[model samples]
Structures are given as C-alpha cells and as structure tokens.
Target: MSDLYDNLKRTVEDLAAPADEQEAMLRKARVGPDELALDFDAFAAAALNLVESGELSSEAYEAVRALDAHLVAFSGANNAAEWTEDALYHSSNWATARELASKVLSLMG
Candidate 1:
C-alpha cells in the first residue's frame, strides 16, 4: 500500500486506541485552531492516490466522502463568514454560517 494509505490506516487505528492514547495521538495530529483549513488540492491528490491504488476499503471510502462533504460545507461557511465580517458589517446570516463552520472545522481538528 502507498504511504498515504498507511498513514490513514494508522490514524484510523490510533483513533480507535485506548481513550488516553487516542486523545494523545489525536492531539499530535491535530492542527492548531488558527490552522484548521486544509489545502484542498493536496487533500484531493492524496485521496485520488488512495482510490487509484484501491487501498481504501468501502468503509474507508465512505468516511473519506463524509470528510470531503464536511470540508466543502466548512469552507463555504467560512468564506461566507469572512465576506460578511469584512464587507457586510456582520450580517446575521454570516454570523450564523461562521458559527456553524467553526463547529465543523473543530471536528476536523
């Protein structure tokens, strides 16, 4: 399997480890609050590699799909929030979208 697949497998396994260990492992991998956004191009390249290699099982693929969906929603909400804050004078819709996006981004971390 590719290194990306190996890394993903290890991360998934680490997530399933004992509670304390899992927490520690996650903490190590987690990006800081200020660095929550991923480089979607890089993410897509890695994901495509996994798919092309058939390294991801169906369950893993499903999880990846869910992650992708979350990323998209989070990005949209984030952009909306930024626009509202910078140009729209903090509209309620922008605030609400930002709040929701923050929650989703937190899950990724």
Candidate 2:
C-alpha cells in the first residue's frame, strides 16, 4: 500500500487548509476534483492514459474511475462549510474520492 489512507487522513483532519495545499495533495496522489481546476477532463484522461502507457495498471484505473463516478454522481452535492480559502467547497464526494483513491493506492503496491 502507498500509505495514502494515512496521508489522506492527515490531510483531511484540518479541512481548513488553504486550497493550494489540498489541491497539491490530491494532484500528488493522482486523484480528486482538484485537477478539474486545470482542465475539465484532465484527471480522467490521465488515469486511462497512465493505464494505456502501462504506468498505472487497468485495475488501478478502475478504482480511480469509481472515484471519478462519485465526482460525477455527487456533482451537485456541494456544501458551503467545507469551502477552501480559494472558494471551492470540498463536497461530500471528496470522501468517496479519498476512499476509492486509498483503495487504488493500496492495490498498486
């Protein structure tokens, strides 16, 4: 496992970090809506591309994709309280993203 759960557990504890830190963590893990800020389909495209390049296995992509599905499913379930300093709410989908990201990270190694 990549210790992503532990890392994420640590990250989520504050839930009030500046948006940059949160986004950095998500990008470093190659997961979450944080990437959507850079490009609409960037996150999703990267996973499949990684799989295709044999960088990330297909199994990992599926787990990542499930997280993406949650991002899609809960696209409207925004909450005002979790908004980072940058003004983007973390959303309930973040939990789902983190859970699935942890699973994918665990499986990879």
Candidate 3:
C-alpha cells in the first residue's frame, strides 16, 4: 500500500504539474466567452480514457464514484463558497479522488 501510495502521488504530481502546452491551451480556452469552457465532462472523459487504456486501476473507479457522490452533495448546497470550501478541504469525496489518483499513479509507475 505504501509503495502504491508513493507511486500514485508521484504520478499525480507529474500529471498535475502544468506543462507549457497544456497551460497555453488552458489560457486560450479561458480567453473568450464563445470559447468552449472546460467542463467536468471533459475531465471525466480523460480520466475514463486513462482507465480504459490501463493507465489507471479499478481502484480509481471506486474512488471516482465516491468523489462524484460528494460532488453531488456539494452542488446541492445553497452557499457556493461554503460548498467550495467543503469540497476542497473537508469532503470525503476529495479524499477518495486523491486516493484513486494516487493508486493510478502507483500502478503506472
């Protein structure tokens, strides 16, 4: 578990680190009102693709499921700021997502 955890953490840090091309693309994507805004669907698709490609393990799927439940709860809240705070700092969903991501990274390594 520790080996998996460490590997997963390294993989996520590498992937999450903004590369120049990705950064530029994100900047461009955010530039115009007409530009297609980044959406959760796109992110989910990418993650799913990783799973399909064998880059991520089945553990990631479980984590994502848990995270989605948390996101649903967060979305139902009235206070947007509070929801954001909870999602980022206090939600079990976020923890699950992190755990999944780490597991995936470990598998990749």
Candidate 4:
C-alpha cells in the first residue's frame, strides 16, 4: 500500500514539476515528447486501477482523469517533437498541463 501511494505520489510530482524539471526527469527516463502522452495515459491507468481495487479515493481518480484528458488533447494539437525542453518554455500547452498536474498533486495529497 505504501509502495502504491509512493509511486503515485512520485508520478504526480513529476507532472506537477515546472516544465524544465519535467523535461529533465522525462529525459532521464528516456521518455521523449513522442511518448509523453502515453506516459500520462499510464498514470491514469495506474490511478484507475487503484481506485477500482479500493486502494485510492474517487477524488484522486478524478484528478488523474482530468489531467489525462487535458494532456491527451494537448498532444493531439501539438506535434510531439514540439515537446522538447527548449520548446516547452514557449508552449501554452505545457503550461496548462503543469497547472492541471499541480492540481492533481494537491488533490492526491
């Protein structure tokens, strides 16, 4: 249970991070812009699984779901290549994602 919480916390924190830090963390994990949406989807799946198994609250699940929706939409509008660390500073989409992620992080806590 602690491990599950910890993992979810870490993922939300990553999403909640500033653009530069999020890019850095993703780069460190070898996850580039092309895979960013997939990463978010994975987070949603994990959160949903926890909720279904009665390990997480509906509130947390909703938080994750909202972020997932925003990010996936953002992905559809922008080229994955534009997700580079350099481009993130110029992107409104990244800003929105970070905002939603921060909200999710706070709600999860």
Candidate 5:
C-alpha cells in the first residue's frame, strides 16, 4: 500500500520477484563506502505502522528509532560485522514491541 511496504514485499519475495527488482532491493540494503544511511526502511515502516495503529506507546516507538539510529550510525563504517550485530539488536526491541502489544490486547479485553 505504501512505497516502503511495496519495497519490502519485493524484498521478501526474493526469488519470486524479477531478477532486476531483487537485485535492486539487495543493492539498496547492501553495505558500501558510498552509502550514506542504513537500509532499515522496511523494518522502520513496519514498526511505525504498528505504532500508528495505537498498539505501541510513543516511548516504545522511540526505542525502535534509537535502535535504527544505532545501525544507521555505522552506514559509513567498513565493518560489516558491527552493522550486522546492530541490525540484530532488533530482536530485543521486538520483545519490547511484544510486551506493548500484550498490554494493548489486555486493555482491549
């Protein structure tokens, strides 16, 4: 429905997508010296969507932003391993999201 969603879907589709499109997604998410920012576009969009849905608190949203920033800060760095570890930090943030989601569902019930 949105550009980020479309781009993300194409990425998930991977082998099913046209070769050129898949390559494009990989290129966007690829690490390189010329890169100016991390490619967390899909992850950020999905997280914001949930926050916009009123399922997560603003503080939780900020936590996600912080994690994104942590990874983005390494955009210009040459170490791929550090970038990957920062990206993996999403797991802990997802746990926070799950806790928020549970609270929202409890309130709903």
Candidate 6:
C-alpha cells in the first residue's frame, strides 16, 4: 500500500457514498469554493501514480479510469447548478459517478 492508494481510497469512498453523505463530505472538506475539485484532483493524481508505479491491476485501473472520465466530463460541462448540494441528488451524472466509483472500489478489493 502507498499514500497514493490511501488518497485514492479516501476520494473513492467519498465519491462512492450516497448523495447526502457525499455532500456532507464535500462540505467538511470545503475551505472556500469548488471543494469537489480537491477530491476529484486527488483521485486523478492517485490513478496516475498507481498506473506509473504498476501497482494496480488492469481491470481495477480501467474502472478508475472510467469513473475519472465520467467525472471529468461532468465537471467539464461547466454545469455549476448540477454540482450544488441540492442538485446533486437529482443529477444523473452524479448518480453514475457514484455507481462507477463503487464499482472501482469493488474491483480494487
């Protein structure tokens, strides 16, 4: 296990959480604004580190990659409204991200 794995685990846990729980996590991590960016960035870095280190299985790495792509797309859309705490519960992208993150966790395990 590495710090990259720990960071990835923490981020993925938050991402895999239920909407309300995830929002609580975001709020707790918030320093100013766009708090989700922090964790999302951590996830990206962790995946990259693991890939470079050859520490993760291909299947697990692909799962992480898929979730990363999904989230990156959602965030890239510039749809600020959907990122809000209230909007998260109703956002299909968030739902899919959560599902994908959970799948990644399962694959990693």
Q: How many clashes would you count in candidate 4? A: 0
Ranking by lDDT: 6, 4, 2, 1, 3, 5
- Model 4's alpha-carbon lDDT is 0.71
**Model 5 Cα lDDT, one tens digit per residue, 1-109:** 4564444333223322333443465568774312212233354547667557665556655654554454455444464553332333343433332343333333322
Question: Clashing pairs in model 3?
Answer: 8-106
Q: Write the per-residue lDDT of candidate 2 for residues 1-109, one digit (tens) a residue.
A: 1334333323333222444666776667675544442332344445555666666678867776675565456444464333333343445445455566567666555
Residue by residue across 1-109, what tens digits does model 6's lDDT show? 7878877877787778887787777678663224554675666656866867877777888888888788777664567776678766887888888899889889778
Local distance difference test, per candidate?
0.43, 0.50, 0.42, 0.71, 0.42, 0.74
Best by lDDT: 6
Q: Which window of 10 residues has the lowest lDDT sum in candidate 6?
A: 31-40
Q: Kindly give the stretch of ten consecutive residues in candidate 5 with the minimal lDDT sum.
A: 32-41
Model 3 error, position 73 (Å): 1.6
TM-score of 4: 0.76
> After superposition, which runs of candidate 1 have C-alpha atoms over 4 Å from their true positions?
10-31, 34-41, 76-109
Candidate 6: lDDT of 10?
75
Q: Lowest-lDDT window of 10 residues in candidate 4? A: 74-83
- Among these predicted structures, which one has the highest TM-score? 6
Off by over 4 Å in 2: 1-41, 77-92
List clash counts for every candidate, in order: 0, 0, 1, 0, 0, 0
Candidate 1 vs candidate 4, TM-score winner: 4
> RMSD in angstroms, all models?
9.8, 8.3, 9.0, 2.5, 9.6, 2.3
All candidates: TM-score: 0.39, 0.48, 0.39, 0.76, 0.36, 0.83
What is the TM-score of candidate 2?
0.48
